[model samples]
Target: MRVASEMGGVGGTTVMLAQETGLARLVEALEGTAREIDVTFARAGSQLGEGLGLFEGLKERLTTLSTDLSGPEIARAGTTLSGLAGELRAINDGLLQETGVLQQLAAHSKDASQVLERLLEHMRLITILARSARIEAVSVQAAGRDFGDFTSEIVALTTQAQRTIQNCARDHDHLSALLGSALEAQRDFEGRYGQALSALAAKLEQTLVEVTGRQQRSVALTSDAATHSGKIAMAAGGAIIALQSGDSIRQQLEHAIKALRLLAAVTAGTGEGAALDAEARTAAGIVLRRLEAAQLEESARSLAQDADSIEAALALLAGDTAGLLDLVRSLYQGDGGRSGSFLADLEADLAEASDLLAKCDRARAGVDRVTSAMSTVLDTCQQTVAALAGTVSSIVLIGMNAGLRAARIGTGGRSLVVIAQELKFAADQVAADAAQLTPTFAQMQETSVGLKSGGRLDAAHFAALDQAMSESLAALRQTGDRLAATLDQLTREGGGFASVVAQARLSFSNAGAMSDLIASGAAELERSVAEAAMPDDPAAAAAAAQLIERQVWPNYTMVGERTIHQAIVGALLPAQAGAAAPVVVAAPAQDEADDFLF
Candidate 1:
């Protein structure tokens, strides 16, 4: 029985061991699956992180660009607006630069304009020479050869003047292009940079306000202590000592107040009517009034020299009050004295003014803080402008160097003459190009002006284009989806799927091609319209003669005309399976002898 028990136990142990091994295998499989899932999740997270990094980079780039453009836009707008005195100084700088360029151009124009003047003078001289030739029948002694030579010389001179005029025109065009590019770049820079600077300034102003608030509390506490000390000294009947103590206290309080005022001026939200400034002034005023009205003869005698302290406080308060009143007057566009009853209503007026002043000062200080921050941004913009100006200067110098080669050409030399001719030809081409570009520039200017003023046509056109595009795309997508659903239905049902697929494919292919054509043609159409009213190409004129020669005369005048009857006949001819025969119409005759031509 013991042997049997051992065998059973061993069997049970083997079974248990086998079960444990199976469980371990299952656990290993589950762990492998879990690890795979973890790896997948980790890969997805990494991909997301990379995408976010790219998005952040794009956002930073856009922000920087927006800032650069905004500054120039604001600068330009501020100059245009008389109310923005803040930007007047900046605007003046831009004006100075523009004026400098204009002065240079005007000077250059004076010299180059002489070419036209010379051309006219030479023409007059040629006319005189032509008249002299007409006056004489034959060779006029020694002057005949001279006249011929003079004519040739004058012609050459005239050609040189023409070439010079052409050069001047080319230069003018180049200058115009440079100026346009510069202005556009400047405007873009100003718009972006100004917005960024303004935002930064606002943030700085907020920071200043928090700093100033803490400082105000310190001043208030010091002034209160001085008041308490004076009150205690007066109660003790040591009038002389009390007055001397108060005098010292007042001076200390004044110094503290002044320090607070200086801090308030520097802080954001602490401007013309800052609460701190108003509170300081009010405290000083109260102390002065009480000291002046007090009946302390002994104290007065001892502190007689200290009277200046009280007077100083009063003066400071008065100055602040005057300043507050002036600010109010400026806002309302009126004189405070003209109100006539301001002093009579002093307490109410003072209280209201003090509150207003505090608010104004805070607001003004905030604006100042913002402006200061903006100045830094403007400095950066100026640096960028300087860089751009350098690039423009380089471009101008390169173009000028190219122009200088034409100036060295001598009249008699064939190579030099050809060079001069080519230069003049190139200059004429430049004039033509300018003439072509001027209308486009004018149109762009008009469009910009319209945008600024909010014109109706632009709004209407944009709205129409947007609506049309959206509607068309929606319709196309809906049709395609419907066709796809139809094909899916045909396939599932196993009924005529092949025919339906072929029809749908053909329809979509045609629709897509049409859509592409229309989209591509839109720009081409606009260009064609703009060019339609301009001069025709000389090359195309050659084709016109050929086309004219290919024309065939019809035996009947009616052959070219296609009326409703003709259309009906043509439509019926295929159905009838007959050759199309021209229908002849008889013309109305004034007389029976007139031959029929139709």
Candidate 2:
């Protein structure tokens, strides 16, 4: 009976030790897996957050570049260029009209010069007729002695008429010289002005072409950037969803770890195997609840969504980058070179036009001086004509006096009366010629003023337009370059974000798998503990005790003089029921030196 009781006690203790060892190992596995899950959760959350952050940053940058900077700048540039092109076209049209006007003016000037030539010839003919009349008067004088003073008066009037003719000829020559100089200036201005306008027009057309091309590219690139920005926003949202799943998984792992620790504590006690099994089942229930709550499958679904969203975003960004790259390629291919050439040509045209304008200013100054000199010469001619008029009037009066004297002397005064009448006609003719010169002088002054004012105004307009166009083109180019650089940076960052999201997804998957493994291990350990055999018979307990005493007790006692073996033996060796005396077992000689009171 005693032996059977000892065997039963040893068997129960052995079963309890086995359960404790299994529970400990199971707890170790659960803790290790939980730790791994925690690490994975942290890493996945960090990665997901980083990816989302990068995507958001990229979105913001794209928004600023596409919406705030590049888009508006491109549109403004397009509008400005369109306006400039219209202005250039209008200016070119005006230039064409001005060229036609200049041609007409040149033609009219030639005609006016020809008319002046005829007027000069007529004046010479009139002077010759006056001289012939004077010679006839002198020849007839010899026929009558009383005609001597009349003949002398005729000679004086003829000499004065010759001087008047010479002065008119000099005035005509001066007017002709001024007309020749104006005609040459007009021809030179027309040629140079036309060439400058034509060159400017061609350059403006080229610049417009390049601007239009870049505007199209900007539209496409900005559209692509906007699309990519939307995609990035979606991707970031998806990544956040995936990270939420990782959070759920982490929570489940923590519960599992807690349940496993509870199970280990219960199994390590001296409870019955059935109680241990019950506690393990309870732990398993907790694990199941944790798993159900973990929603690993949901996490996987979220990860899939994240991946799809990221991929879509990547595709959008890739397309955006491709468009930007095409624009960059276009810029690098030949657009920049063409633009530079256009700028260079425009500058050259502007410089030439500016030089022409300077020349025109100089010409205007020269024209002013010429007009002033001509006005002075005209004033001098008028003075000379006035003096000649006074002299002719004096001659006429003298002829009149002679005629009175001759009339007083009877029919002898007839010759004197004819000379006085001739003198009066000659004076009237000279006064009429001087009156004609006033209108010609006024026309010359008006022409010089028109040319100076008109040329200067056109030159100023050309300079202003050219400067505005150059500044606008330069600003557009700068905007394009900055946009290209921004696109390149966004592309690089988008790629990095994609990579981070992918890695995070993989880590989440691994963590989920580890959690499942830990749950499986806990369940298996519980099952093993529940199925483990327990010795119920006292005889079997006695045999197990004997084996433990021979093997386990000796080794266990070596750890200390008084050990847990003594406590267990003392507890297990209580007296049997209806026994008269307590059962005392003899100590072995080898254990005699060891004080064991059981």
Candidate 3:
């Protein structure tokens, strides 16, 4: 009876020792797992919070970008490049018209050059006739004085003609040069602007399209990120709640440990050779059976269930954390060097187009200067030619007088009269050439008027547009930088969060494993206790069970533990129901539909 009372089974002494060691190990594992749960969850919560902060930074930056001029309005402003291109096309057309005028003027210049050549030839003939008349005077010595007077007047007229022709030639050459310069300037403007107009027009149009598309994509991406952030926040909340619930599992494990310790105390008794009495052993057996049946099984099941919840919650956290990371990466793909900055690129293209337009203006100004100077030169040449024609007429009158005077003089002076006739013919030719030159000059002057530009674009309008667009692009670039920074922060924080959540999930699994080992070991000990021999004295056992329940009641912190103890104590010591009564003032609802213990 004493041997049965000692360990409560045949050779139960050895079995009890083994189970005591197993219980110690189980308790150690449970303690470690519970402690690890706290640490892992703390880290998980902290990391998740940091990720949330990073996402908030993104939201704030996005809001600022939308509020500032850097947003879609900048794209709208950039679209004005197409209008500028239109203006450029118009300006280019004006240059083309003026170029046609210069070309026409070039044809008129050719005609005037021919007329000037004829006039120069007639002046040379007049000069030659004056020399010939002088030679005739030398041949006819009697008429030498008369011929000398005529030749001298002829010489003066020829000298004046030479001067007038030289001046007209110089003026024509200068006008021709002006025409060339204007044409050349127009060609340059046309070549550069034609290509630029096409390219800038196309590029600006394409850029506007791309910007609009990006704006739409940005809106969608921003919405997605916001939704993902909310999900992450929700997942983090669930994980934190699940982590908090793990504490209750720890409490349950603590109850199991306390029960095991009480079992040890009952078996160990108060001192050496002071083993527990027979009824006390029975009480210990009953306590083990009830603990395994109610508390250990429930604790084990709760552990499994709570651990799964923790794993699932943390797993969701990990998934969403990774999703957030990807979202951030997608947001900043512009920084990734694949797509490049949008507004900055548009700004560069705008600058190029602006520069082309400015060059076109500069070329137009150069043409204007050429045309003005050419008109002045054409007017001066016409006046000189008119004066030359009058001088040729005076020479013709003098030549006629010389011829008549020589004819009156006699046969010896007849040769001088012939020379005078030749001189008159040359003078008439000069008058004809001068008359042709007049119409040519007038025609050239009319064409020079056509060289004036049709009109010009308002330079100030474009200047202001460029300035506004530049400011908008700069602001947009700044916003893009801030967005990139936010994405980078999100990536870093989210990566850390993923790692922490994974670890937390792993820790929950580890705790579950420990709880399983504890439950299995507890089951073995409960069976050992149940199989242990009991004392024949039922009354002492009942009284001892009641005393044990009252003693260990303080160890039951959870209401479930108290309720389990209450039911078991009432059954084990039924007669003392009034004494044990209900430890719980209110019979709280049982959780055996039995997932989580409150």
On lDDT, the candidate that comes out on top is 3
Candidate 2 global lDDT: 0.49
* lDDT for 456 (candidate 1): 20
Clashing pairs in 3: 8-532, 8-533, 591-594
lDDT of each: 0.31, 0.49, 0.67
Clash number for every model? 27, 4, 3
Alpha-carbon runs more than 4 Å astray in model 1:
1-146, 197-214, 218-598
Cα lDDT tens digits for candidate 2, 488-571: 676577667767756765665554456456546645643543433333344433433343233223322121212433443433
Worst 10 residues of 2 by lDDT: 575-584
Return the candidate ranking by lDDT, descending. 3, 2, 1
TM-score of 3: 0.70
* CA displacement after TM-score superposition, residue 359 of candidate 3 (Å): 6.6
RMSD of each: 57.0, 15.5, 6.3
**Residue range 460-547, candidate 1, lDDT tens digits:** 4334433543443344344334433432332232223222223322322322232233222223223322322211332222222121
> How does candidate 2 fare on TM-score?
0.45
TM-score of each: 0.18, 0.45, 0.70
